[model samples]
Target chain A: MAKISMIVNGNPVNANVDPRTLLVQFLRENLRLTGTHVGCDTSQCGACVVHLDGRAVKSCTTLAVMADGHEVKTIEGLAADGAPLHPMQEAFREHHGLQCGFCTPGMIMTAVDLVHRKGHELSDEVIREELEGNLCRCTGYQNIVASIAAGAKAMAKSDLA
Target chain B: MYEFKYHRPGTVRQAANLLVKNEDAKLIAGGHTLVPVMKQRLASPPHLVDLSHIEGLDTIEMKGRSLVIGATAKHAEVANSAVVGEAIPALAELAGLIGDPAVRHRGTIGGSLANNDPTADYPAAVLALGATIVTNKRRLKAEEYFQGLFSTALEADEIITKVMFPVPKKAAYVKFRNQASRYALVGVFVAKRPSDVRVAVTGAGSDGVFRVTAFEDALKKRFSHKVLDGIAVSADGLNSDLHGSAEYRAHLIGVLTRRAVEAANAKD
Candidate 1:
């Protein structure tokens, strides 16, 4: 077993985990943070997407030990308590960005990171390009990109307000 | 994935020692490719030595006329690196063009090259740039490195420390990407290094990435698209998949090579 410490959802969490435990497995199984879903078990699916030190990464491909000392933000930590859904989540809901909720959390997490990095000016082409790794079989991706753009504008407005 | 002992060695030397000491060990950098294979039960090793914590393996530095990219440098780092953009813009574009943003954040150049998937993008860049693969033991030229499909000259436990790509006069990567997975269906890298021109094609050939000698010679003489019109590459030894036939890949190699050259020569 490997003793690992890292900032998880803005809280410092430590645990004794098998060295071979994947970050997705550790988060979903051990920590009981089942908000992050497992889609393909391969990195190809974005169902296990999360923020590692503020950047999007497929948690399924990352080992728990590799995440030690780093900050991890799973889908569970996206919105603050008593606060409305994070702008991205709200946008997804408004835009009907989901058919099944299986890929929603991961898509929102990845979209949030994309908007944070690329900002609101991103074109549909750019969004599609950025989302090449993330597979969304349900929405056809138009709504997903729209949701991201809407979320970006909302986040910007919130900041200005 | 089958259960295995995992070691996250903080230092490169420690990681190398662990790999060497273990009889059935594989180095896992980003795990973007390895983990997937492991999960499929395609590759099962007794130990996996994770190399993420090692310091100095994530750097991108300029050395003389070349760019020195640390082995563990992520695709995102390379795509956003000013050094890579200024020195070799094609490399930056290629890095940006790799499998989506999530894969870019976690995938490493070393892991990609070491994995050497036949359809991978980095092989074309490394071969076209005439780069050097600097290992713990020795440096290998790109021509001497790639042997065949899913094959490389690297011995077990010989950890790659850095990849050195000399600044080419001009370079560009044009890929016919697989629509869903985004793996290159047929990708070509065109580069002019000093007076010499190199054309390397990936995804198309059964031999993996290889230079187009005919295109290289023509480009060497004229260095333009018209010069490549007369050249004909045989369909033999090219890859055929559901995406394309061998002939289609052969044809694409020519088309992408020309486009890449034109893109390279286009004004910034």
Candidate 2:
């Protein structure tokens, strides 16, 4: 076992874990930050998406040791303390972006990252293309795409305020 | 995943030394490929020499006529790099078309080339662009480096330090991806230099990424999609699976090659 320390959702977490423990497992099992789902253990499903050092990456494929000394932002980290909801999260709720909601956390996380990187002017084509990793069995992508666009606009507006 | 000792080396020398010391150790850059395989029990290295801490191995710069990308540079870095965009726009575009954004953030060019997954995007670009694979021990041409699928000419203890790609006069890559896995069902990369033209195909090769000499010869003569009008790609030695038959892939090789050529020409 190796001792690893990282900043997760604004908190510094230190734990001793097996070298093979994935970042998703570390987040869900050790830290108890279960908002980051694990729909597919393989790297295909972006259900384990999270921000490592400000860049979105698949947590399921990342080893806990690999994230040592890095900052990880999960679905639980999006909202501020005592805040109602993150702009992206609110947009998803407003747009009805989810059906069964299994893929919501990952989708919202990924959308936030996309907006953070690509800005608010993302075209529908770009959103669909960028969403190639995250899969929703409920086939609720139409609303998800709308939610991301709305979320990006709201975030951009907030960035100016 | 199985138990393994993880070693984070601060320098290329330290990483190479660790590799030499451990008999069944594997060098990990981004861990995008290795980790998945480990989780599936396809690979069970007793030790993992993580190279993420190695300094100077993730730099992207232009040195003379070549664009040099350090081994640990992630796909997202390359996709968004100003240097890569200015020097090799096609390379940047290719990087962007790699796995999704999440995978792009964690997958590195060195890891991709070293793993040499038959359906990978980089191999076609490397081979077509005639890039050089630089290692701690020595530098090798792409042709001399890739041996076969999931294979390279790298020695057991060697570590890829960087890759040097000459700025092509014109180049483009077009891929038909497997919608589910996002891997290429058939991808073609075309590069046109002042002196010669090169075309490489990935995902469709049964053995691995291979160049299309016939297509190259035809493109060299005309440098246009029209030149490949009736060119036939033999189905022999091509991959045939549920996604596409060998004949279908053979047909795509011709079609994508034309598309790549047209795209390259438009860019130029």
Candidate 3:
């Protein structure tokens, strides 16, 4: 067993992880931070997407040891004050972005990263391009793109304020 | 993923030493491909050497007329690099068009080339640009480097520290990308070096990425897409999956090659 320490969800997290422990496994099985869902063991599905040092990455492909010195933000980290939803989360709720909610957390996280990178000036083509890794069978991408577009605008307004 | 001793070596020498000690030890650069395959039980190494912590293995240097790219350099870094854009814009564009933003941030050129998945984009670019595969032990020319599917001339302990791409006069990559995996169904890389013209095709053949002598011969005669009007690619040893048939892939190769030539010519 290897003892690994990382800044997870803005808090210092320490755990004993097996050498084969993936980041998604560590987050879900070890720490009980089950917000990041594992859909496919392969990197094709973006259901395990999370922010590694503010960049979106599929956690299943990332070993837990690789996150030893990095900062990770799962879906659990997006909320604040233990009450309110993040603007993206709120936008998803308002725009009817999710259906089954199996891939929502990863989709939201990836969108958040995109909004942070591309800002409110994102086009549909740009959003589609950024979402190449993420797959959502339920939403069919229409409402998800709508949610991200609205969320980007809302995020931009919040930043200005 | 299968259980294995994970070693995060601080230097390439340490990683190489680990590899030398254990033949079963596999180098994990980006984990974009290897880890997933491990989870599927397709590949399981007794020892896994992680290369992320190794310093100086990610530098991009312009030495003389060649752009030397560290093997561990991320796809995103190459796509955004000013030097790569100035020296070889097609390379930057190819890097940018890889999987997605997330994959680009994690996938390394070294990892991609070493894996040599037949459908991968980098192999076509490397072969067409006449790049040298710089391993710790030897420098291999493009023709002498790639042996077969998911195989290379790299030795067990040999680590590819860098790749040297000669500054091309013009080049372009055109690919018919697979929708789900984002891998190329059929891709072509066309480059104009000082002396000769090179055309490399990937994702269409069982031999993996290879230069097209017919296309090169035609392009040498006339450096235009019209030169490739009558060239016929035999589907003798091509890959045929659900995405496309061997004949379909061969057809796409000609189409993409013409498009790549046209794209490169647009720049010149």
Instruction: Give each prediction's DockQ, rounded to 2 decimals.
Output: 0.79, 0.88, 0.74
**Model 3, B49-122: lDDT tens per residue?**
98988888989879999999999999989998999999999999999988877778789999999999898999
TM per prediction: 0.97, 0.98, 0.97
Compared with the true structure, what per-residue lDDT tens digits does model 3 show for residues A1-161? 77889999889998888988999999999889898999876776789999999888999999899888899999998886576788888899999999999899989999998888777777888888888888889889999999999888888767311
Over B20-110, each residue of candidate 2 has an lDDT whose tens digit, in order, gives 9999899998999999899999999999999988888999999999999999999999999999999989999999999999999999999
Off by over 4 Å in 1: A159-161
Sorted by lDDT (best first), the order is 2, 3, 1
Better of 2 and 3 by TM-score: 2
lDDT of each: 0.89, 0.92, 0.89
Relative to the unseen true structure, what is the C-alpha lDDT of residue A151 in candidate 1, on a scale of 0 to 100? 81
Per-candidate TM-score, chain A: 0.94, 0.95, 0.94
The digit string of per-residue lDDT tens for model 2 on A60-99 reads 9999999999999998898876777888888999999998
Best by lDDT: 2
The better-scoring model by DockQ among 1 and 2 is: 2
What lDDT tens digits, residue by residue, belong to model 1 across residues B124-193?
9999999999999899999999988888999987899999999999999998988766789999999998
The residue pairs that clash in candidate 2, if any, are none
